[model samples]
Target: MNSVLIIDDDRSVRSLLRSILQKKGFKTRECADGTSGLEETVGYRPDIVLLDLLLPDMHGLEVLDKLQKAPVTRAIPVIVLTGSTDQENRLSALRSGAVDYIEKPFVAEEVTLRVTTQLRIHDLIKSLQTAVQGLEDDLKAAGTIQRALVPSEVPAGIEDEIRWIYLPSSSVGGDIFDIIPLNDHSYLVYVLDVSGHGVNAALISVMVHRFIEDFRSSRPGDREPFSLKEFMRSLDRNFQFERFETYMTATCVIADLQKGEIEVSNAGNPFPLLLERKYTQRLDRDNNGAIGFGMVKGSTSVHKISEETRLFLFTDGIVDVRTCEGTRLGEKTIADLAESTRHMELDDAFSKYQALLGESLPGAQTSFEDDVTFVAIQF
Candidate 1:
């Protein structure tokens, strides 16, 4: 039988929990307060912990914190028990690392269901971890290839400072950003996000990078300006016959600083938010439609890109990130952050925006749901 540790200040509550769990064929260990609960958790190493929020020696949250910090107890699932029955408490408990939170006056069946679900999830995680560990060598090689594809430094003659933040939701993700300079006066800045996660998505990202490089090489002299429409048409034609089932959404912005103008284009990508000294606006697209690549056989309509403006391009991972309360951190929040930090340097502005998002959603883990990548450039 799986072992469980029940921590509550009240003797009656502990006894009731012990009876229920024992009847369900689980070995139960009881602790009278938070202090002893923490010690027992480390010593006994229970598969699950039933912890009460209010305790005599210390608060349940504090006990949770300690348990999470202790290497021996961190992986064990904890379910918080509270009398408050408030949404805030529930959200806080979940964010603090509790697998689930149960309000007082709980049903036996509900508790059993939650406990069983968590245990199953824990087992699944362990299995996945073992499988991944077996592929450690392959993963290392893949990491090397991925890093090589990323530009170590922004291209020369690009006056604007470029900064990027990338977090792959899995071991690998499809979000990619690149800043390639065609010449001293012209540059191509693009951010692309593939529709999925993992190895397949990452492989697609590499293919996109290779295609972009080939497209750049095919273009003629730097003296004559490159046409954004012509480039998109060529790209659409090149991949029109490919057999790949996956499709990619991209936002490509071409800028000619010498002419003080830019041309913005998108293919099913989130609108690139522009942050000016005084205001913020999203670059316009054609009917708000997505531009499809890879297996999709369609021509993407190119829009006029604006110049003398800073461009902020990102994947849905960043824009649609959620808080523990299930509140979305939408495009508006990003726009506000960019506008508020417009006067600051590019790197500083990026850091401030990331920090603000982190503060708004507090948790031990600081990662978005999907692969997140952002690139900002000022002309």
Candidate 2:
């Protein structure tokens, strides 16, 4: 049952309103002055309030302001009751936070209808608030689990050689990467970027991460280097657009620790950059279509790693970011930045790269349009 607080100085007016509202299935409380009305509202926590404009101690507008200001009582709908026909006072009551107004000679039927309407509206707002809170809670939990999918520390045998940065535009995103040791001599390093953003994209990325982890565990630790091309084929065959309704871009690299040889593959993702002391090489000569379409065959090429080589792998979020003038930060610019920072510490290099990216875009941007993921390994 909904409750109503009636704040009227006249006993006769309060009696009439209480009798009329109670018959309409409303629980009612009454106060003869503004001070008592406020006190009762905080204690009773009514669904609505019927406030009379002329009170013994304080004006009705003052009471309305206090009701609206107090957090505990603010949500209760206030309907002003007035004996004046003055347009100014009625306007003042509304401006002071009254949800509605009732004239001095209010009819019983009008009173019931207005109160019922406000109650229904208030209930709907409360329902929406509850639903929004639930969704936020679910996203927070998913973000916690999705973040765990990334490598916390570089794979055991290859520590202090890998540096990375991962930033999701929201609580969860479609970008994921890791450097996993296949054995003491070979490691699997890759960055997978699913199309789109938010929860749907995030869910697909998590599934892909799980699939790769399962495949990793199935292989013998001392086995030959994992096949990047075959793994890409498996991924394409499994995550067809008809099944998951989305596609993804990926750059997978197999690094050989003992031979200093690295095999790199690309699938609709930015080509891996081989940054040398004086030259930068974009590894793949051709760019392939994204996975999940089952259209393009996966391809891989081998590169001889030199002592000063640094392998840079990243999602397109970096090169695709645009300035306010619609200038896209192309791959060439990233190559130049990586080449310039080759001799600096890994953390400093990445920091300078990010700072330059921000400076390129004029204005205050709190986030990117897509998830940004970058990983660099010193060979």
Candidate 3:
């Protein structure tokens, strides 16, 4: 049953409203003054309130202010009751969050209809608020699980200085990186980026993460260095045209610790950068499209690294930023930044790169505020 609160100083007016309200099947509570009315509004927690503009000790507008300010009573729908035709009181009551106004000479049928209308509206708002809260809670939980999936410590047998960053624009994002050891000598360092944001994109990223983990476990620990070309092919075949769209791009690097060799196959991602105190080497010549309905037969390249090498593998979001003049932060700029910061700490390098992008562009901040996931592996 819907509950109604009636606040008025007049004894006869309160009696009349109570009779009218009870006849309409509303459970009513009455208060003869503003003080007791506020107490009843909070204590009883009615679905709606009918407040009188003229009270014995205080005005109706003051009562509305007190009710609206208190959290416990703030949400209750208020319909101001007035005997005087004061436009000021009506305006003040409405401005203070009253839902509707009823004149002192209000008809019983009109009062019932207005109260019923406000109650229906109140219920609808409550329903929407509940749904929004549920969605927020679910996204928060998904983000927590996705962060847990991000690889932190390096694989076994590799004492490399592994530094990585994953920053999502929202509760969760589509950028994900993982390091899975395919035996003690070879490990797969892969970064996958789905083209989009929110739960749908995050879900796809998580699925890709799980798929790669399964592939890592499928191989024998002592197996020959995993073929770079074959790995890309397997990924292309797994996410077939029939299933995933071609927008999910990846950069998968397989490093052989025993041979001091690293091979990278692109599935539409930023090329890996080899940085050292001496020089920088940017790998691959061709840019490959994402793996989806059609496989572009992406370019695969191999390189040998020394002990002083620091390799960076990242999503394109970090380097795809644009400036106020419509200039995109291309491969050359990013390559130069990586080379200069080669001697600096890994975390500092990443921060400086992002800061430079922000300082260069006007719309760059919002457009490039995408999910950035990158791994820096130093030997």
Candidate 4:
């Protein structure tokens, strides 16, 4: 049974309330002053507290404030009992943390109804809080798994030549990228973005990442060589919109160290930016729609890479970031930022770019509206 503590200075009033509450199948406790009432509240942890505004030791509003401030007894519903007809005191009681109020000469039926209603409300709030906490725990677990899909370290021999950054809008996000060493002379680097953000988008991204990892691990020595175009086709065929009801944008860069060339294949993603010694260039000009559409064709092209050549692959999150003025920075602004940072070290350049992006946001906000993935590779 739910419990109530009646804190009133009048002996007859306390007895009357206790008698009525016990008859209504409630557990009851009584105190003659605010001090003893607070002590009883802590000890008993009652479901509800009936507090009289006129107490001998401390003002009833002071007791209510203490109850609301305490972590242990804060959630217990408080109903203020007042003999004074002052509207200000009633409002003050509510503002001070009383959930409801009982006027002087309280009716037994009104007291029971108010107590039961507040108890039901309290129970509902507790249930909702429990459900929300469970969801947060699940999302945290999913975020850990999603983070594992991204590369924590660059492949050997090219660790210092690559730099990247990723930020999700929430605990789990739709962006993922990795650098896998294909053989002694080449590496496969790619960045992918699912259609949306949060858990659903993150689930699809994990599926795609696992699919690519499986393909990399299961390739046979005697089969056709690793082709970017064929890989795109395989991804498109497996994750069609008819099956998943979603789509993804991706850009894959195959860097051949021995051949001094890099093959770029893109599908409905931002064009890869290539930084040379003298000028910056945009690779993969053709716009093939996003993957999972069942009709996405791969557009693969080759570009020469010198020691000074730096190739950048990023999702639209970077370019689509809105400035304080609510205008998207756009591809040209991103290109200009990349060109301006070309003189710095790779890591420093990434830091500078991130700072610039942070400055573009309105006011003190730091996070973007979408998941972001940025990768830079120097041959």
Top candidate when judged by TM-score against the true structure? 4
Model 4, 252: alpha-carbon shift in Å?
0.8
Q: Count of backbone clashes for each model?
A: 6, 0, 2, 0
Q: Give per-residue CA lDDT, model 2, range 227-320, as digits (tens).
A: 7778888888888988878899999988886888888888888888988777889876645679999864767888888778888899998878
Task: Name the lDDT value of residue 120 in candidate 1.
Answer: 95
Stretches of candidate 3 off by over 4 Å are 155-157, 321-333, 351-369
lDDT of 4 by residue, 154-252 (tens): 867664388887988789998999888777777789999998899999999999999998888777432545788888989899988878788899999
Q: All models: lDDT? A: 0.76, 0.86, 0.81, 0.87
**Per-residue lDDT tens digits of candidate 1, residues 1-379?**
8888999988888888888788899899999998889989988999999999888998888899899888889999999998765677667778989999877776888778888899999999989998888787676577568767877788777877678777777667788878888877778887777778878878878887898888787775575556666666555555442445566677777777666766777666677887655567776545223334433333334333344467888878887778656888788888877888787777788898767657655567655678888788766
List ranges where model 4 is wrong by over 4 Å.
Answer: 220-224, 361-366
lDDT of 3: 0.81
Ranking by TM-score: 4, 2, 3, 1
Off by over 4 Å in 2: 324-326, 356-366
For each candidate, give its TM-score against the true structure. 0.60, 0.90, 0.89, 0.94
Q: What TM-score does candidate 3 reach?
A: 0.89
* Cα-based lDDT at residue 220, candidate 2: 63
Looking at candidate 4, the ten consecutive residues that score lowest on lDDT are 217-226
Per-prediction CA RMSD (Å): 11.2, 2.5, 3.1, 1.9
